[model samples]
Target: MILVTGATGRIGSEAVRLLAGRDLPTRALVRDTSRVPKDGAWSGVEVAVGDFDRPHTLDQAMRGVGTLLLISPSVPGQEIAVIDSAVRQGVQHVVKITNHKATPDSPVDRRRDHARIEAHLRASGLRYTLLGPNLLMQNLFAVAPMIKQTHGFVMSAGEGRFGMVDARDVSASAAAVAAAPAGHVGRTYLLTGPELITYADVAAELTHALGQEIEYRRITPEQHREAMVQAGLPEPVAASNAQVFGLIAEGDAAWLSDDVASLTGTSPRGLRAFVTDHVDAFR
Candidate 1:
């Protein structure tokens, strides 16, 4: 059995769908049973109510699970205990979702946390695959309201081009790794889209997709943090998000890779296609 954590999230949900589509015995670890879909692609998958904070629930969730898709929770430092549980439960392989810029000296706090998780997973002695994806295209959905209201989105990433990947593609890669763990063990894949595009380019794509003049409004990091806080994000999370944008503005995330295509046997989706698929959000 394959166990998927963060099963209700973007990447985890898609991974569960893909794996189940391939007839794999998949189990989803969800905190809230109500969040799991009752029908559609998720109809037949097993749902286990579990939490990383509550380690006792994990043993039941992980029982008979050989391969684990270890998607770290958004809360920091939660993955350490989750990995320990996986190790204790005798999970043979772990496919971890990490950041593309994760490293020991990463400037962003989130990336640093991912680096720590990667380190812990490495030392756990289980076969593992680390998927480090670049900026997610789904992140643009957060600014959909701003675009609908004023035909513009706000950001601090000025003239910095980063390979923005679709979350679905990352899920596809994860599914592939989970199904066939032989070739992927002990590998770190840097998943990215085919092109590197700046926020200005993204605005142009949105303009064309929505048939309106969409703009990318540049702001300072402090201003971005304040705007995020106004949008209901916590002050610390908003500051951390703004710092990531600052890193992007400094060209830290400006790169492309073929790892997505290599793993999933298909090219990653571009921004224009992503905008078209999510045109309703912008409208």
Candidate 2:
């Protein structure tokens, strides 16, 4: 049996869909069963009501599960609680979606948190595979409203090129790893699109997809943080987000890998493909 945490989230939802109806009995841990897609992809999959904040629920979710797909918010306690439960429940393996590289000083605050969790997981002695995806193209949806309203979006990732991947591709790669996890134990896969692209490239893609001139307005990280705060993001969250964007400006994410294709046996979706599929969001 396979159990997926954060089953209603972007990557987890897709992973559950892909894993559904497979020979392995797949289970999705969701706080609300209604959140699970009532579509063909969810067919034959079991639903386990669980919460990371509740240890007993996690234990119940792990009942008779051999492998786990751990995809949750970057809350250390949440993942740690699940990991502890997995150890206690005798789950043999884990497939985790995590930071591309979780260094202690990662500019992305979430990655810093993931670093701690990674350390704990390593110590727990559970066979695990780490799938770390680069910047998700889906993140653009956050600026979609502004793009539609003003034909432009503001960002702090100036001139820097990063291999931005589609969340769908990340989900596919992760599902592949989770489906047959033995060969992937202790491996770390850095998932990315085929090429590095800057925000200007994103704007160009959006322009072509939407049939409208789109703009990429570069701003200082401070300005970006101020804008986010004014737009109602908490000060700390906005500041951390701005810091991550600044790292992009310094060429932090300017890297590419074939790991996604290697795992999923398909090319990772590029910015153009992602923009084309979601063009209406920018319209």
Candidate 3:
């Protein structure tokens, strides 16, 4: 049996679908089971209730589960405790979804937390596979309103390009690793989209897809910080988001890698395709 945490989320749901399509007996963990899409109809999955804040519930979720996919919780500091619970429940292996740039040497506060989680996984003696996925193209949806209103995309990412994989691609790569019989244990996969794209480039695609003039507006990282603050995000989260955007602006996320295609046996989707599919959101 396989258990997927955060199964209702974008990437998680995609992972669940892929796992089920592969005929794996899958159980999804969501805070509300009602939110899980109809099995094999909407997204090909079934769900059970599990909350990260409530570790006791996890043991029930883990019963007979040999492998667990631990989706990083939105509540940042809760991973260690939740992982510990899964370990105690006799889960033989775990696949962790983590940020791409996270490393032990990373000084950024958020990446450091993921690094610590990786360390814990290493020391726990459980078989583990780490998926460090790059920036998600779905994040561009946050500018949907701006695209609809002004036909423009705005970002703190100036000249920096990102090999931003679609969330579905990330999900597919993750499911592949989770299903591996061996060879992936203790391995880390750095996943990216098939192409490197900049904000200006994305805007160009959106322009064509939406049949309107679209432009890229570059802002300072400080401006990004302020914008997040005004959006009602907590100070720390806003600052951390700004820091990650800073990494993108610095060209740290630009290199296109074939890890997604290699792992999933299919080319990851491109920015143009992503925009075209979700054009209604921008319209």
True lDDT of residue 267, candidate 1:
94
Reference-based TM-score of each model: 0.97, 0.97, 0.95
Please give the lDDT score for candidate 2. Answer: 0.91
Which one wins by TM-score: 1 or 3? 1
Candidates in order have lDDT scores of 0.90, 0.91, 0.82
Q: Which pairs of residues collide in model 2?
A: none
Name the lDDT value of residue 196 in candidate 1: 94
The collision pairs in model 3 are: 40-44
lDDT of 2 by residue, 1-283 (tens): 8899988998888888888845568999999977878667788889999899999999999999999999998799999999999999999999998998798887677888999999999999999999899999899999999998899999999999999999899988988888889999999999999999999999998988888899999999999999999999999999988998999999999999999999999999888888878777788
The RMSD of every model to the true structure, in order and in angstroms, is 1.1, 1.1, 1.7
lDDT of 1 by residue, 199-254 (tens): 99999999898888999999988899999999999998999999989889999889
Q: By lDDT, who's the top model here?
A: 2
- Residue-level lDDT of model 3, residues 115-223, one tens digit each, is 8888888898889998888888888877887678777766788889888889999999888987873768888888888888888888889889988888988888899
How many clashing residue pairs, candidate 1? 0
